[model samples]
Target: MYYHWIDTEKPAWAVTEIRERSRRAWNSLFAEERREKAEAEEKAEQERELKEYYAEQHRFFEEMGKKNREEARRMEEQERQRKEAREAERQRKKERARQAKATEEAGDGKGKYPRWTQ
Candidate 1:
């Protein structure tokens, strides 16, 4: 009795189709990995830019604060000088009035000159 075996050879078209499917699957996986990597890089760059922006804003406010303090100090110094000048003027006016009163009270010849000359 002879035994019959089934044919096990694959067709040429079937082998080419299998190879094409495998190539497509590997290409899809590689594309997905590249996309994920790009997204991660973009997120990191955005975070770095945000941090830099905040730092710049902080530095600007600090500079503004320092400038305001210096301006206030300068204004205070100017006011103090003005007050000193006003006080000096008042004192000078009082001294001049006192000297005038003293000169008027004393007669012209009797104050600083001899009476014989008049």
Candidate 2:
């Protein structure tokens, strides 16, 4: 069919060229649109993966922090127990020395420091 664009009937070869050009233009436009859509989808997928990676890393750090806290608490408890044991041992030693002093003084025929001296 002759195109209505001009006053004269276009030669057959000219009509074929126009049609091919129009088809190429339409295909290029659609291809560009498809490429844009693909790029946008790829960007969104990358963002999603990055978010998941960050969340996973945060969880790992949080778990590590919790473990560190538990370990510190265990160490603190152990130190407290050791301190208490040391105090108990010191008190026992003091009692033993007091008993030894009493026994020695009693055998010396002196009861203890005299009330008169006080």
Candidate 3:
């Protein structure tokens, strides 16, 4: 029997022909289902790749954060050292001023002369 493509809504003339064609259509549908399944799997794989990429970025930022903390600590130490040095210098200047004033207040006398002069 000749099959007409335009009238696919009607069944084929023979029962055997109808069954065979139905089986073929079912097989095609199954193939389409498998293709869709594969596409979904591929999409899932792509999402996983993106997730991994972000995770790596997160790790990199964490490392940078540690480095930043170290740098801040070093800067604090340097600041502390500078403040201590300045404080010591200030104390030394004050001590020198006090000693000079005391010398000026004390009058020079022949009795205060060195033992060699005596």
The 0-to-1 C-alpha lDDT of every candidate, in the order given, reads 0.90, 0.91, 0.87
Worst 10 residues of 3 by lDDT: 109-118
Superposed Cα deviation of residue 115, candidate 3 (Å): 18
Instruction: Residues 6-108, candidate 1: write the lDDT tens digits.
Output: 8878999999999999999999999999999999999999999999999999999999999999999999999999999999999999999887677666636
| Residue-level error in angstroms, candidate 3, position 66 | 1.4
Q: lDDT per residue, candidate 3, 1-118, as tens digits? A: 9976875465446767879899999999999999999999999999999999999999999999999999999999999999999999999999988876676566364466533334
Our tally of clashes for model 1 stands at 0
TM-score of every model? 0.74, 0.79, 0.63
| Highest TM-score model number | 2
Task: Please give me the total number of clashing residue pairs in predicted model 3.
Answer: 0
Which candidate tops lDDT? 2
* Model 1 regions lying over 4 Å from their true place: 1-8, 107-118
Report model 3's TM-score to 2 decimal places.
0.63
Lowest summed lDDT across 10 adjacent residues in model 1 is found at: 109-118
C-alpha displacement of 23 in model 1, angstroms? 1.8
20 Cα displacement, candidate 2 (Å): 1.2
Give per-model CA RMSD: 6.3, 6.2, 7.3
* Predicted candidate 2 versus true structure: per-residue lDDT over 53-75, tens digit per residue: 99999999999999999999999
